[model samples]
Target: MMVDEPPASARFVVIGGGVHGLSAAWHLAKELTASGENPNVIVLEKSQIGAGASGISGGIVRNFYRSEAMTEVIAESVAIFEDDREGFGFHQVGYLAVVPEVQREDLEAIAEHQCEVGYESELASGDSNCREYLEWLWPDVNSEGVQAVLHEKRSGWADAIGTIRNLARHAREAGVRIFEGVEVIGLGYSGAEVSEVITSGGAIGCEAVIAAPGLWAPAWWQMQGLDPLVTIGEGDSAEQRPLTEYWLAREGDYLLPGVGLAGNAGRAAPVVHFDHTAPLYSDRDGELITDQPWGIYFRMGMTGGSVVGGGLPLEMGPDFELDPYGPENPKQLAGDDLSEFFTSGLAFALKRFRGASDLWDSNPNGGVLALTPDRYPVADWTAPNVYSILDAGHGFKMLAVGREAAREILGSAKSSLLAPFRLSRFGSGATHVVSKSPYPWT
Candidate 1:
C-alpha cells in the first residue's frame, strides 16, 4: 500500500498484484537488499491486490503430484507457507485424497513418490480402513466406496486474500514499491528485449519485467504478438493456439452463524479430496445419469459454509465476467447447472451435507484460471529481459514459485526447481501427464 518516493523507473517491474507477482517482488527485493545491491523493484496491479483468481481460490496446498518437479516444488512451497513470517493464515491440518477402485494403483504410486520426497503420507486401503481413518480425522464424514486413501500430513488450506495481502506487506518492507489501481496496458519492446512497461498511470522504464497476468495472460500474449501456447503437430504446427480457459469450481458454505459446529470451529476440518463417484440427483430432472465421474473437495470453517467444488473441466473464453463478488454477477449468486452438480453431488456423498444445497448462498462463484497445455504453470524467461510466472491453474503455488523465480532473476540460483515448467516444455514434448487425481492442476 505504501510506495517510497515512488520511483519513476525501476530495475525490475512485476505485473499483477496477485500472489505470484508480489512474491516475485518480495523475494527479489529481499535478495537484492541482502546482497547490498538494493535494486529498485516495482509491482503494478490492474485492480486491487488479489482481485484476480487468487482472491477466490480454495487455497489448498499439497505435495501430491505425478510430476516429480511439481512434487518437489510444492514441497518447498509448503515449507515457505509454514514459515510464520509469511503469515497467510497457514494451517497444517493435512490433506486427505480418497480414491475409488479405478484409481487405487495410481494413488498408491503417487503416495510412494511423495514419501520418497521426504513428505510423510499415510495410505489406507479398503472401505473399512478408509472409513476408520476418515472417522478418526472427521467424525461426521460418510466414507462409502472409498477403496484407497492418501493422507498428506503437512498439506492444508490457507486464507487466499490474506496470503496475497501479507505477501504485499512483506514486499513493501523489503523496499519493493507496489502501486495499486494502476493497470499495465502494454509492453514496449526494444528489438530483442522488453525495454519498458506501459501503464495507465504512466510508462516506467525497467531493466526486466515479470508478467504474472493470471487469466489475462492470453490477452497479454496476443498484445505482444505471440500466442499463449503453440503445440507441435496439433492443428497447424505453424499457427499458435489461444490459452485454454477454465471455470474455477465453487460451492456453498455451511454455517450455524452464532454457534460453531464441531469440526467447523477454527477451520478444524482438514482438506478433503473426494475421488469417488456420486449419484447425481436433480430435483427437476430426477436422478440424472452421466458418464463422467464426479470429483470434489471441501473443508469446513469458511466465512459462510463449508467450501465444496471440483468437477470436470469447462472451457470458455478470456473475456467472460470476472467479478464474482459483485451483487449482479450471475456466476456468483445464481444457481446454474454447475452449481446444481456440486451441491447435489456433495449432499449425496457427505451425510452432514444433506441440506447444504439449500442452506448455501444460492450460487457458486469463483474466478477464471489460465490453463496451459500440460495443465501446469510456466515460470520461465520468455524473452531477453521479459519473464513469465503464469500458473496454469495452480494459483496457490505462487508463493514458492515466486521465491524460486526471484532466486533465478537475481542470479543467486541457476535454474529454479520449476525448470520443468518452462515454456519450451510444450514444444519439447515434456508435458506432465495427469494422473487419476481429482484435481487436474495437481
Candidate 2:
C-alpha cells in the first residue's frame, strides 16, 4: 500500500525508520495525541523497516553489562521484552557463556559480580550433560583457571521484524504517518536547529526533526560536514583473509537440540562445552586458546531445548577502513567478509562440534547492520533537537535505546534514562568505558 504524504504543517518529521526511529515516532505520536493535539508525525525511510540492522540481527536481548548505568537502562528494556507481550513477541530461551579452563577463576569472579547484581548465572561442569560434547567441553581446569559456563535463564532472543512492525502499526493507529522508500538528501538548518528536512520526496516542515539513521548515519553526518569513522567497503573480496586476523571468530557453540537434562524445576538449563573455542574472544589480536578442562552448556527454549554460545569479538582488521558512507562496492566489503567469516565458523563447527553455524540459515543478520566504535553503542544527544543511538558492536541487545531514544524525541521530561550515553562522553575526557574482561565478548 502506498503511504500518504503530509502537508507542510506537520507536527514532527523523523528521518530513518529503523528500530530506534520507529520507536521514537511511536512514543512521540502517543505523547502528542494524549495532549489533545492531532499531531502529524511523519517518518521517512529510504528503505523498508528493519532494512538495516534492526531487521537482520541475531535477535538476542540482554543487558549483560559490567556497568551499573547500562544495566539500569537495559533493565527498563528487559521489562518491556519480558512483560510487554501484546506489544512485541519476545522469547526467554536463556543464554550460556562458557568459561575456559584457564580463565575459569577470573570469569567466575565476574560471574559472581553479575549474579550479585542481576544475572542468574552458575558454573557448569562436564556432568551437566553426559554427551560426547562433554568430552571436549570443560576440557580440564588447570590452576584456578576458569572452567564454567555462566547461564542466564531470563535472557534470550525475540522476533525482530515483529516488534518493529508492531511499533510502526501502533504509531499509525495513534495518527503517526509513515513514508518508506524515501531518501533524505539533507537538512534545512537555521541557527543550528533543523527547521525542515530535504528528502527525495520533497520539503517536510515540522516543529522538530530527529535523525535515527542507524547504519546510514554517515550520510546525514556528511551532509552536516561531519565525517564518521566507519567506511563502507566492498563485500566481494578475493583475498583469503584469515578468520582470526579480522574477526576473531571460532566455532564452539552450536544449537544442540537434545543434550542432557538441562533444567531445574521449571527453569531452563543446558550443558555448555567449554575447553574448546565455543567461547573464543579477541585478546591481544588473536584467539585465546584454552588448555584446561571442564565447562557447562545449556538447553533453553522449552519446546526446542535450544542452545546458544558466543566466541570472542571480531577485531577490526588493519585493512578495515571504518567508512559507513562510501559507495556500495562489490569487490571486498564486509558482506563478503561476513560470508567468509560465517563460512569459516561453519567449517570449524563441522570439524570441532560436528555441526554447523545456524546464524546464516536462521537469517540472523536478517536486517542491515553496522559496527560502532568502542564496540558497545552510542546513545546520546548530538546537535540541539537531534539525538542518536548506535549499539556499536552490541546493537542487538543494546536496543533498549529504542524506547529511550523515543522518549527523548518526544521531549518527555523523564528522559533521564539516556544520560549515560550522552555524546559528550567522547569529548568530556571521561574514560567511562567499562573494564572489559580480557575476553572480547563485545
Candidate 3:
C-alpha cells in the first residue's frame, strides 16, 4: 500500500499518481493478483495524488462523443464509476448539450450517433422544445437562440479529489506499491526498451513502464528521446503508418453558483453544456455575448449554493509547459487577473449568474493534454516495453484507460478496442477526423 523505501525493482513501473496512473496501477495489480502472479507494481509520484488536472477537474462524466471509440470507452468508464464497489465519488445525474441554430444539425448527428452506439441520449429540438427541456430541468437557464439539446441520461460529474483518492485506495488495497513524493526523473533505455526508471528517490528496475504523467508527459517523452509526434495510419487499418506531428491542448475551468443553483433546479441536477452565443448580463457587469464555437459546461457544486464549469477551447497557441513543484504551474498559483477573466467569461455564457454575489471560483490552475492530430488519445507502445497514455484531458476516461491498458498488457485478452489509438496509426493514416461538434476534441 505505502512504500517506506523504494523497491530495488518492479515488474511494472507506472509514472504519475493522478487518476490515470492510480487507475492503471489498481487495474494492473488486480489482474496480476487474480492470475496468481506476484503483482510487483510500483507507482511513483513527484507529488501527492490528485495533485494534477484530475484533482482539479470539473469531473464531468459523459458518454457523448462523435467517435465510436470514445463513446465506447466513456460508456465503460461510466460503468466503472457506477459500480459502487469501486467507491468512486460519482453522481449519475445526467448531461445536457445545448447547441445553437447553426449547430443544430451537428448536434443531431452526434445525438444520433450516440444512440446508435447504445447510449441513452435524447434530442430535444426547436425553440419550444429546447426551452421546455431547460425549464423542466433548470428553470433559471436562458434557452434563447438554441436549436436543440442532446441529453445523455447517464452522464454526470463527480468530486475530482474524492474520485482520485478512491482510486488510489483501491490500488493500495490490491497490493500495488505507491510511493508519494517520488519523482521519475529519467528512463534508462536498453536499446529500444526501458530497463530502469531513474527517480528522485532511487532507481527502479522494471520490465515495463506505463507513463501517464498528465501534463508532464511532453517533458517525459522529451527526456526519453521519443518524438512527440505520433504516426497516423492510412484508412481504418493502424497497421500501415506515416509520420505526423502532434501537439497538446490547454484546458481551463471556473466555478458557478453551486448548491444554491442546485436547490433551485432540484437535487442532483443534471450537468449542462452551452455551445451557442447569447446575450448575457449581470447586475455587477454589463451585457456580454457568448463566444462562438467554444462552449462551456456546468454542474452542481459539491457544496451548497454554487455550480462548477469551465472553458473548453480547441488548441491553437504554443504548447503549454508546467513546473509542478513551483509557482510557474498555473494550477498552483492562480492570479486574481486570471480568476476574474474566467468568471467574466462564464458570465458571458450564463445569464443566471449575473447578480450572484462573488460565487465564481475559477480553479485558475489548469493543465495541458497530449492531443493527436485528431485530438484523440494516443495509447499504445511508443517504444520497446514503453506504453504511452495521452488522455487529452478526458478525466472521466481514467477507469477505462487503466482497465484497457492492463487488459492488453497482461495478454489475457487482445483488445482491438485500443488499436485505433496506437502510435503507429498516425503514420498509417488511421487517424480520426475532427467531428462536426463545436468542440474540436469531439
Candidate 4:
C-alpha cells in the first residue's frame, strides 16, 4: 500500500523494495510471527516495488560460477525459487554454459563442487563432446571453438516483476507494512548504531536497517559517511578501487512467431550462455564483429514468440548519475550498436537465428548495475545495526540471500554461506578470485 506517512517507530526498517529487501522482509515477518514477537517490519521504497534493477533484470537463474562459495549460495537460492516455482514464475528449463578451452579446468572444478554439494549438473569436456552435447539440444548450434559445457538441469529463468509482487504479497500477509514513494533521505545515528530512518514523508525509529538500494547503493553509502573507495591487495602492491562501479547493459528480444526454438526432446529451450574466443561475423553482412573474447546469454522470452538476451556491458565513470534509474529513463538505455551486436552475435551462435539481425525490436531493454570491486556481492553489516545487501550484479538470481539475511537480522548465528561476502574481506585482501571468462561476474 502507498501510505502517505510512515509509522513513528518499527522494529525493523528495510530500504529498497526490490528482490533482496522484500525477500528479507517476508522471511523476517514469518520468523518474527512464529517466535511470538511483534512483526513490526516496515519496507520503505523510493518508488514502487520492482521499479529498480529487479524490474529490468533478465531473470536468469543459474548456479554456474567459478567460485565454490558462490556456487553454494546460488544453489540454495535456486532451490528457493524452485520451491515456489508458480509463485515466483520460475521456469525450470535448465541452464547451459558453453566456454572455450581455457575455461575447461575452472568448469570441471565447478562441476565437481556442484556434485559434492548435491547440485545436479552435467559437464561435457573437450571440443568434440561439447559440440555433440550442444548438437543434441540444438542441431544448428555453432560450437566451433567450444571446448566445455556445464549444463544445470535445475536452473532456469523467472519472471522478475512477478516474483517481486509475489514476495510483497507474502510480506504483507505476514504483517510487514510496505510503503511506496517513501524515499529514505538519511539515517539518524546514535553513537555507532542507527537510531531511526529519516524519509521523505517522516521519520521511523527502528532497531535495525537493511539497505538494498540496488544501483543507488553508492548514494546510500555516501549518506552514511562511508567511503566508496577501498584498498585492494596488501603492502606496496596495494591498489585503490571503487567499492561500487556503475555499468550499463542493453537487453532486448526479437519477435519470431511460430518459431518453436525448443530443445531436442521437444521441451522448452534452456537458458544458454556462450563464451568464446572465436571471431564473430555479422549475419547481415558477413563483416567481422570481433576477433577478441566475447560472451552472450539468451533464452526464450517470458511472453513467448521472442528470444530475449544481452551481450557485454559498458562501464560508466565514477561520476555517473543514478537519479533516474530505469530503462524508461533515456540516459539509462543502451545505444543501437549494442542491439546490432547482440542480434548479430545471436545469429553467429545459432543457425535458427540466422536472420535475427533484421528481427531486432525497436524498444530498448536495459538498466544500470552497481558492481563491487571483485564483481561478487557484499552482504554484511556495513554499520553497527545496518545490514547492506549489496548484490553487485547478481541480485535477481540469488533470492535466498534475503532468507539467510533475515535469520542474521533476527539475532541468529552468522551464516557460513554469507561469510565470504563480508565487508572486511577487502581490507583483509580476501576478495574472490577472478575468472578467465570475459564476463566480470562469471
Candidate 5:
C-alpha cells in the first residue's frame, strides 16, 4: 500500500496492496471495530489494486498439501474463501485429478492425506465420472490408455481480482482508508521500533506496520536492513521454442477432468481442477518459476501459454525495488518464451487427459507480473507491533488466514493461531523447502 499524501497519524499502517496487505487491512478493521478500538487503520498501494501479481493469479485452492504448517494455516484461509460470500468469490467446484499411470500411487497417497484432514476425496476408475468430466469439457480428450483418476471435492479456482476488490471494498466500509498511487519511500523508526512510514506525499505516523512487498520484498527488506536470495525468472529464453505437440506427464503436474463439463462433473466431489506443470522452454538456459504471487497457474494458463518468453515463469519473476509511493520499475515479458511454455504445457495436457491440450492455445499469455521466492510465505514478528508475511508458494489460497496472522500484530482475537508460522521457525532452522506439485515430483 502507498499513500501519495501522508495521514497525520494512524494506529496501524498496512503496507502493500496485494492480497496479503488487503487481508491485513480487512482483518484489522474487523478486529479493531469488534474490540471497540477504532484505530486509524490505513492501507497504502503504490499502484492500482492487484497491480503486482495478485490480479494475474490462477486462483487454485486445495487442502491436499505436504507441509503441515501450510495446510493448517491455509485451511483457515479456505474457510474464509468458502464461508464469506460478500468479500471473496470462491465457488465450490470439484478438482478431478485425472491421474497419469505413473503418478497413481502419489495421487492416491495425497487423497488419503486429504481424508485424514476431513476432505471428502476418493480414487475413481477411469470409466467413472472423472473420465466423463474430461470428455465433457475437453470433448476430444485422448483417453487412450489413461489411468485411474483422483477426485477431491473441496478445491477449485477463484476470481483473483474480485477477491482483492472485495477485500478492499469491505475494508473501506469497515472504516479503513486506502490510498492508491501513493508511493511509500522509507521507514521511520522511533527508538527501536517503526514510528512512521515516509512517503513521497509526506509522512504518516503509525504505531505499527506490515511490509507485504511480494517479490519486491527482498529489495524492500534490503532497504530495511535484510538480505534475501531474490531473483526474477528469465522472463523468457530464446533457444527453447514453444511447440504445439503432446506428451504425457509422468510424475508431473495434476490432470484435470474439466470443471462443470464432463472432464469434471461439477459435483464438488473431487478435486476442483488439474494442477499445472513446469514447461521446458530451452535446452541451455534454465530459469525456475519463482513461487511468487503470480505463480498460481491453475491449468490452461500454462498449457496454452509460452514457456521462455523473457518474463517471469508462473508465480516467478525478477527482483525490483519499490518505493510504495513512488514509480515502481515494472518488469517486461514477451516472445517464443511464451510460445514454448504454452507448447510444452499443451503437449503435456494432450498426453495426460487425452486431447485436453486442445482446450488451450499455442501461445502463453503475455503481460503478466509476478514476485518470487514464494514456495512458502515468510512471516516474522520482530517486535510487538510489526510483522511480515513474505514467503508464500502461492499466497492467494492462504490470504484469508495470512491476513489473520497479520491481524495478530494489530491486536486480533487469536494471535496464537499465527505463532506456529512466526519467523522463529526460520531462526530455529525449522523452516524447510517444500514442494506441493499436485503429484509426481520432478
Candidate 6:
C-alpha cells in the first residue's frame, strides 16, 4: 500500500524500496513478529517500488563468483530462492558458464570451493567434453576456444519486477508500512547516531536506519557527510579510487517469435553464460566482430523469445544522474555498436541465434550499475545506527542479504557472510581476488 504520509516516527526506518530495502523490511518485521514485539517498520521510497535498478535487473541468480565469500553469500541466497520458488518468481532452471582455457584453473578452483560448501555443480573440462556438455543443453552450440564448462544446477533467474512486488507484499503483510513518493532527504544525527530520517513528507524519528538507496547511494553517502572516495589497496600498492563508479550495461532480447531453447527438449533451459577468447564473426556477413576476449549471457525470456546481453560496459562519471534510470534514460540504452556487438556475440555462440541482429529488442532492459572498487558489494554499518546495503549491481540475486541483515540489526553478532564485504576492506586491502574474465563482476 502507498501511504500518503509516514507516521511522525517509526521504530525502524528503511530507506529505498527496491529489493534490498523491501527485503530488509520484510525480514525485520518477521523477526519482530516472532519475538512478539511491535513491528514499527516504515519503508520510504523516493519513487515507487522497483523504480530503480531492481526493476530492470537481469535477475540472474548464480554462485559462480571467483570470490569464495561472494559464492557463500550467493549460495545462501539460492537456498532462500529455492524455498519459495513461486513467491520469489524463481525459475530454478539452473546456470551454465562456458569459458576458455585461460579461465580453466580459476573455474576449477571455484568449482572446488562450491563443492566444499555443499553447493551442487558440475565441471566439464577439455574442448571435446565442454562441447558435449553444451550440446546436451544447446545442440546448436558453436563455441570456439572453449575448454571448460561449469554448470550450477541450482542457480537460475527470477522475475525482477515480480520479485520486488512480492517482497513489498510480504513486507506489508508483516506490518511494515511502506510509503511511496516519500523521498528521504537526509538523516538527522544525535551525537554519532542517526536519530531521524528527514523526508520530503516529514521527519520520522527512528531508533535505527537502513539505507538501501541503490543507484542513489552515493548521494546518500554524501548526505551523511561520509567520503565517497576511498583507498583501494594497502601499503605501497594502495591507490585512491571513488567508492562508487557507474557503468551502463548493454542488455536486450531477441524476438524469435516461435523459438526458445530448442535443444533442451520442452523443459526450460538454464541461463547460458559465455566467456570466450575466440574471434567473433557475424553470422549474417561472416565479418569479424572482434578477436579479443569477451563475455555474454542469455536465457529464455519469461514471456517468450530469448533474452541476450553482454559486452564491455560503458563507464560513466561519478556525477552521473540517477533520476531517469534503466532503459527509460536514453543515455543508458545500448547504442548501435553495442547492440551489434552483443547480438553478434550471441550469434557467434549459438546457431539458433544466427541472424538475430534484426530481431534485437533493446528496450526491455539496460541500466547503469553502481560498482564498488572491486566490483562486488558492501553491506555493513557505516554509522552506529546506520546500516547500508550497497550491492554494487549484485542486489536482486543476493536476497539472503536482507535476512542476515535483519538478524544483525536486531542485535545479533556480526554476520560471517557479510563480514567479508565490510567497508573497512578497502583500507585493509582485503578486497576480493580479481578474476581473469573480462567482466568486472565475474
C-alpha RMSD values across all candidates: 3.5, 8.7, 4.3, 1.6, 9.4, 1.8
**Candidate ranking (lDDT, best to worst):** 4, 6, 1, 3, 5, 2
User: Which of the two, 3 or 5, has more lDDT?
Assistant: 3
Error of 5 at 43 (Å): 0.4
How well does each candidate superpose onto the true structure, as a TM-score? 0.88, 0.69, 0.84, 0.96, 0.70, 0.96
lDDT of 5 at 117: 60
List candidate 1 stretches off by more than 4 Å: 1-6, 233-240, 256-267, 282-286, 289-291, 303-313, 317-328, 331-340, 355-363
Cα-based lDDT for every prediction: 0.73, 0.53, 0.70, 0.86, 0.54, 0.84
Question: What does candidate 6's lDDT look like per residue over 157-181, in tens digits?
Answer: 9988889988998999999999988
Most lDDT-accurate candidate: 4
Candidate 5: lDDT over CA atoms?
Answer: 0.54
Clashing pairs in 6: none
TM-score of 4: 0.96
Best model per TM-score? 4
**Rank by TM-score, descending?**
4, 6, 1, 3, 5, 2
Instruction: State residue 265's C-alpha deviation in candidate 1, in Å.
Output: 13
| Worst 10-residue lDDT window, candidate 5 | 242-251
**For model 5, how does the per-residue alpha-carbon lDDT over 1-442 read when each residue is reduced to its tens digit?**
5424557778888878888888888787887788787847888787777876576555666665545555566667777877775456675665555544544555666666666666666676554555665665555454443455565566666767888898788788888888887767888888778888888677888888876766466556655665454322233421221111111111122223342222344322222333333333322233443222111123322232221211234322243322332113233233444443433333334444233433433333333322222245556665456777673436777766546665667553555556566544543445433444442111
Of the pair 2 and 4, which is ahead by TM-score? 4
TM-score of 1: 0.88
Residue 178 of model 3 has an lDDT of 89
- Steric clash pairs (candidate 4): none
Regions of candidate 5 where Cα sits further than 4 Å from its true position: 1-5, 98-109, 124-148, 229-334, 337-363, 366-374, 412-417, 436-442
Q: List model 2 lDDT by residue over 1-442, tens digit each.
A: 6566645647677777777777777777777778886767888888777676566444666545555566566666667666666566676755555444444454455566556667555545442332232333323212122345556556766666787887688778878788888887977877887777788878877677767776555556676665454322233432222111123222222333443224333343332223343533222233543432322222232245333433333454524433332224222123333433333332332233223334332211112235443344566666676666654544555445766776666666546667756554444433234533443432
